[model samples]
Structure formats: C-alpha cells, structure tokens
Target: MHLILEQGDLTTVAVDAIVNAANSSLLGGGGVDGAIHAAAGPRLLEACRELRRTTLPDGLPVGEAVATPGFDLPAAWVIHTVGPNRHAGQTDPELLVSCFGRSLDVAADLRARTVAFPAVGAGVYGWAADDVARAGVAAVRSWDDANPGALDEVRFVLFGPAVLAAFEDALASV
Candidate 1:
C-alpha cells in the first residue's frame, strides 16, 4: 500500500473505505465518528443500529473492525473500529496498533483499493498524537509489507496540524 499523510476531513475523502474511530456502541459519538455519521446521513446510523441488533449485540470491542455501507459519503464502505481508551487505563500500544491493522484487514476482505483513516485513540480517548501516529503508521506499514497488493492506497486523514505533523514524521521514519 502507498501511504499518504493528509490533513483533511475524513468525510470528503474519495476512497473505497473510510475507517471511523468509533466507540463500542457504534452509535456515533464525538470527533471523527460524529463527523462520519453526520456526513453519511441517517442510513449510516440505521446500518449501525442493525449491526448492533444482529451481529454486534453487546457492542464492538476495542481494536475490532466491522464494515458498513458508506451511504451518502464518497467512499463505498465505512469501516468502524473502536480504539483503546487511555484515560480508562487501557494503555496498550498493541491495541492501538490493532485499530490500524484490523481496519486494513477488513478493507482487504472488502477488496477495497483505497482507504482513509483518522487518528484513532487521539481525541477523547486521551492518547497522544505522536504515539497514535507511530502505532498507526507502523501497523499500516507492517500490514502492507505482509500483504503486498492488498490495497493501492492508505491515507492518514488527520484532522489538525499537530496530528498531521506527527503522522508525517512517523511516515518519514517508517
């Protein structure tokens, strides 16, 4: 996969899938999750509700990813993954890495050529931007190395300058 570090809105990215940094409920919370849910319209929430009813009865676990239709968004699919809550004492970097790797795995299963990702665990979850960037970039790079042609492009669609800079540095080193 060709990794791109971009500072922009995840909702408008033209890709096969956009990975949402969702909560366990998948019912749409704040930050990237809220933005994606809002941009994709009501159908996105409806789909999430259906998933909760059928597949994810308890709720999506941290670091696990599931796919839903993008609805009104530009992407064909919306991949939702719950990141670890650092403030809640979930400080494992492996779980943070899983957020990226599992999302890529889901995208590969969907045969998605391009995917966009937000800075998972970096907002209300209380993870530092630099740490998130390192784990995210490393996870994606590791996956790309393991699965040669799985995806054509994977963009880190950062929301702000600080995170974008962190991701850029991480990308450079990786």
Candidate 2:
C-alpha cells in the first residue's frame, strides 16, 4: 500500500473511504468526528442512529470499526472507529494500533482502493501526536505487509502542523 501524509480536513478528501476518529456513540462529537458528520450531512446521522438502534445498541467499542455511507461527502464510505481515550484511563498503544488496523480491515473488506485517515487519539483524546503517528505507521506497515496488494493508497489526512510533522517523521523512519 502507498502511504501518503498531508495536513488537511479529512472530510473533503476524495477517497474510496475515509476513517472517522469516532466516539463509541458513533453519533457525532468534536474534531475529525464532528467535521465528517457535518460534511456527510443528515443522512449520515440517520445511518448512525440506525446502527445504534439495530446492530450496535451499546455503541461501537473502542478500537473496533464499522462503515456507513458518506452521503454528501466526497468519499463513498465512512469507516468509523473509536480511539482509546487516554484521559479516561485507556493509555495502551495496542489500542491505538487497533484503531488503524481495524479501520484498514474495514476499508479493504469494502473493497476500497484508496482510504484516508485522521490522527486517531491525537486530538481531544489526549494522545501525543508522535505516539499516535508511530503506532499508526506501525499498524499500517504491519497490515500492508500482511495484505500487500489489498489497497492502492492509504492517506493520512491530518488536521494541523504538529500532527502532520509527527506522521512525516514516523513515515520517514519507515
């Protein structure tokens, strides 16, 4: 898989799928989650609500992922995964890796050739950007190694300079 990194809003990226750093509720929250929800419009919320009402009554679990139609957004599908909240006593790096790994799995299962991702757990969730980047890169590398021809591109659509820099550094070492 090709790993691309850039600082931008994930909502506007035109990929086969974009991963949302969602809360377990999967309704809508701040940061990447909020931006994606807003960009995808009301139908996205309805799909999430239906997800909650039918399949995921207790909400999506941290590190696990699910997909929804992107609606008004540029992408065809939105892969939603809940990152571990460090401030909430979830500080495991494996949890962070799981977010990336599972999101990729969902994207591949959807047969999406190109996917975009946010810096999961690196915003309001309280994880350092460096740590998040490192884990994310490592997860992508591992997944790519296991499934070499599964994807055409994996893009990290970051929000700020700091996060982009972290991914740049991590990817450089890869």
lDDT of 1 by residue, 40-120 (tens): 999999999999999999999999999999999999999999999999999999999999999999999999999999999
Total backbone clashes of candidate 2, pairs 3 or more residues apart or in separate chains: 0
Q: What is the C-alpha RMSD of each candidate to the true structure, in Å?
A: 0.6, 0.6
- What Cα-based lDDT does every candidate model obtain? 0.96, 0.96
lDDT of 2 by residue, 116-137 (tens): 9999999999999999999999
* Alpha-carbon runs more than 4 Å astray in model 1: none
Which run of 10 residues does model 1 get worst, by summed lDDT?
1-10
lDDT of 1 at 77: 100
Model 1 lDDT on a 0 to 1 scale: 0.96
Q: Tell me the TM-score of each prediction against the true structure.
A: 0.99, 0.99
